[model samples]
Target: MRRLFPVTDQTSADRAATAPPSPGPDGDREWTFDELAEAYAYPPLAAGAVWLRGNMVATLDGAAQHGGRSQAISSAADMRIFGVLRALADVVVVGAETVRREGYRPARARAAFAQRRAAAGQAPAPAIAVLTASLDLDFSAPLFTSPLVPTLVLTGAAAPSERVRAASKAGAEVVIAGEGPGADPARAVSALAERGHRRLLTEGGPRLLGQFVAGGVLDELCLTVAPLLTAGHAQRIADGPELPVPARFEPVSLLTEGGFLFCRYARADAPWISRDQG
Candidate 1:
């Protein structure tokens, strides 16, 4: 609801020094959804280029989920931002496990984004791209049969023939993204890009995000830090094989509302050193 970083003249040091602490940077007035959309707009890219962003929420204690669901740790403001991200993206990528756990459904076209999407030449609703090696999914579900756009299944070349056939039979397009029995994060991005989906957003369930991180293909991260602290054995926002070196990211923007901190981080320009180099 309030812009906390990249302070503008309205929230400059001089103004803050002379004025009392206000609810938002612009006094009692909160930011509108249009303002938030502008603030979070994707950077311009050359034709055929792709930018992948990961949006996630975690507790103060670093729990990505509570009781196997992220909604438990999410707030209304977070959900609003989630909708905005989905509206802006060309495709929504997710791991199959997340689809099953979250009871995935087709993305409905939002009236608010219809005009913008039309102007940008995007689909009325972003397509859902599921990454699964086994192709173990409910192909008969609405996510595959009723999507405004056809759902995409990203798998490996070595995936089971029967499952891939089933997915194709149910109206879902199967894309081979790896040589092994799993989807390679970088290849998946390229596959989508080839299909004209340059603005990609991934709503991860940890492992999928980890693959993106490990592949060094994630361009930006929009993370919401919940105010509450849940002390339990829970996965972090990313989980996978340890990296040779921790990849650095620079904070691009920060916002807050009702004790929740929304942080945006972009991949740092510096090159990362691998284990052999180190």
Candidate 2:
């Protein structure tokens, strides 16, 4: 189907010079999963007008890579939390590159994600979102082939004519959202927000994650730190002149499993920021 609001200059970064506020516990109350669940009662972070949640796995030594792939560092428990986080999200956003490497699906648990939404008077399934500078996508994959719900493909203005045609032919709903010299996550997230999707869960490939941070879109980060360290150098997360930003995260909570550490970070009330100042 044709996009209602076709974006012409999709690559232009929607960088609002001001940074989004960080989140944390209110008063003495700790921001627990249960509290967030209650607050985002509508399946994900809906109560908030705009909220961004990022999911990534890092190593104990603070390396995002271990072996060539993050799979080497992940354990069964880590995978489960990934699913749980997905289940709670209204829309799952990922980079096309991540889909090429890690592979992605709709991540809809009609029963689980549905149950939560149903209880909160929400829809049964959340849409799967893919960001790409090009409209290039394998429509044959389950992500696009599903006849019921159309996959939302976000692209930039510089997308080729043939690639756009191919995406439309493959039964995908393509929206030219952001453009950049590379990729503009700020525009992409704002485009989604305009579409009525408020609380978005971004499962990044690092480049997009960095773009969001630079663009000031991300509000919360759910990072799973595995106990094991991957010494391999085949990992890539962000691309920029100034890479590896020193971000201060206020730990909402921590969980340890199979020697892995699962930590949640909110931009609000991050004690680490103050510590870093010292």
* lDDT of every model, 2 decimals: 0.86, 0.62
Q: What's the TM-score of each model vs. the native?
A: 0.90, 0.74
Query: Which candidate achieves the best TM-score against the true structure?
Result: 1
Tens digits of per-residue lDDT for model 2 on 1-278? 11111122233232111122212334322234443443222212333356678888887665665544567778876776676666666678888877877767765554545656666443466677888876556878888887335677888767776877788888887777756423467777777777766758887778778777777667788787777655556444443335356655554445555566666667764222212110
With a 3 Å backbone cut-off (N, CA, C), the pairs that clash in candidate 2 are 10-178, 10-179, 11-178, 11-179, 11-180, 22-267, 22-268, 23-267, 23-268, 66-230
Cα deviation of 188 in candidate 2 (Å)?
0.9
- In candidate 1, which residue ranges exceed 4 Å CA deviation? 10-30, 270-278
Q: What lDDT score is found at residue 264 in candidate 2?
A: 64
RMSD of each candidate relative to the true structure: 6.6, 12.1
* Alpha carbon lDDT at 26, candidate 2: 41
Q: On residues 1-278, what C-alpha lDDT tens digit does candidate 1 reach at each position?
A: 77776566554454333321223334224566566677677766665778899999999999999999999999988999899889989999999999999999988899988998898899999999999999999998999988999999999999999999999999999999999988899999999999999989999979999999999999899999999899999999999878999999877677888899989887786221211110
Q: What are the clash counts of all predictions, listed in order?
A: 0, 10
lDDT of 1 at 249: 87
